[model samples]
Target chain A: MTTVHTAASAVSAVSAASAAEEKVDTCASEAAHPPPVARGGYTISEVVSHTGLSAHTLRWYERIGLMPNVSRSHTGQRRYSEADLGWLSLVGKLRLTGMPVADMVRYAELVREGEHTFAERQHLLTRHRENVRQHIAELQDTLAVLDFKIEHYADARRASERV
Target chain B: MTTVHTAASAVSAVSAASAAEEKVDTCASEAAHPPPVARGGYTISEVVSHTGLSAHTLRWYERIGLMPNVSRSHTGQRRYSEADLGWLSLVGKLRLTGMPVADMVRYAELVREGEHTFAERQHLLTRHRENVRQHIAELQDTLAVLDFKIEHYADARRASERV
Candidate 1:
């Protein structure tokens, strides 16, 4: 009935922590960038690699207003800034929590409006935080059910071996 | 810095516990029924209400082999037994875990094979259990980030009031 959370899953947990650290809302000044790029911004492929979001998803995020006013290169290619990566990392977290895209776009809109929306942002995230906790509790219940069934199978296996 | 989990979400937790109790795999002999319906079968609508799955989804579950061999009534209406309700309950929990439908259909096939597949079922569930735990851990990380930002908002609100 006991299942070990393996090293592979642990690595994902570690990465999730780093992603959390990248959350840009509180301190845009602390945004981490790689060495200065050709035009001082990340290319689409670089963002895709760093965020593990598809190039299509990055473009779509911008199109849908999830990523607002992304700077363009001299030739008009998308050039993501360090702050953009931070917001994308946080968006990835909310997406994992299954926050609807419409809500995320609203949240992004608030982000763009700046300081005045902090209270509203707090309320929105608090509501969503509650949702995520309920979601975790449900998954835990599923784990219990799985454990019970696994134990039943184990018992049956032991009985069959004795036969 | 502090958020109440709230009575609304608390009620959902209570229901999830009962839903887990409805899980049918471990003790089919203990399947609960709502006073015996006509022909000892639940109508599709009744199962829909009991399981909170849409009629379309219930049928699709059958179509995808996630629900195997649901008996039909004389007029070709779906006849759900107490055991079927139990299976649906378990299936709903797994669905909440976001287990891939293809894997769930395979799990249903294993369930239909019965005792001989117990070991395989154990292995399958063990793998999924690990996945669910990893998911829960990621959600917790998200919660931590939300908490940090919420606290930052609280600070801003406090400072703005002093002006």
Candidate 2:
């Protein structure tokens, strides 16, 4: 009975290890070509493709202090890390909201200052969120006006046709 | 009896005329200093204040054909009409949505072309409204990300204080 119990426990352990390996494999496959393991570093061209930003714009972002200093590969080309990609993603979203480049640079500065500046970073984001909210409200109001104007045009067109 | 009926009718007529006059006064008062009657001709400075656009920008807009030609007074000073104010208001809203200046110029051209372009104008506005809606959606999503990040910072700070 002791031997049988030991054998069963060993089988269960083997099954569990196999399951964990399968999970990892699944995750790696799901991420495919850009798997986390392979994403330790990216070339400038790779980042340009991933972020859909022009090479010129990426260089400009770096020059304007929007991006932190990128590491260099053996040949001296820019090599962006996972954290850099994450930062670029956030910057892309911020740019969509029409936040000025200067403001983004400020945020980047706060980030570079590390854990001590977390409160300031949070405050900056809160203020920017408020600005975005106000902008969204304004856009909604403008949308209503546009809808009204469009409807007027449609009614006028129908009336003209009826005439 | 006829005299009494005539007196009643006269009273009603006077009340109706007074109501009409009151409506006119209400409208004028609601508009305040920049009443429509007074809006027939605004100087450059007046347009600048009304539109919150710099005089330089106003001139630039005019140069770019984004604005219709302004009339000149006896001394050749530019006089913007109520219609011009209305157009500027529309332009301001469009600008808020980040519509390209060239597109705005096209819209201005459509306006100058008159009634036949109503369909095209409506199409342009409809397209712009869609763009604005998409932009609002993107901003809302970004806001959510910011809120999440802010909450993370708050949590981190709380943890540090506890330590």
Number of the top-ranking candidate, with lDDT as the measure: 1
**What does the TM-score come to for chain B in model 1?**
0.77
Error of 1 at A58 (Å): 1.0
What does each candidate score in C-alpha RMSD? 7.2, 18.1
Q: Over the stretch B115-150, how does candidate 2's per-residue lDDT look in tens digits?
A: 999999999988888888877877887787788888
Clash pairs for candidate 2: none
Q: Write the per-residue lDDT of candidate 1 for residues B24-89, one digit (tens) a residue.
A: 343234446434343547788876666556689889999989988788877898888767766777
Per-residue lDDT of model 1, residues A35-126, tens digit only: 42445577998776666667897899889999898888778998776667667767777776678888899999998899999889999999
Can you give the TM-score per candidate against the true fold?
Answer: 0.79, 0.75
Q: Distance from true position, residue B82, model 2, in Å?
A: 2.3
Which parts of model 1 have CA positions greater than 4 angstroms off?
A: A1-34, A37-39, B1-34
Residue-level lDDT of model 2, residues A60-121, one tens digit each, is 99999998788776687787765666677677677666667788999999988889998898
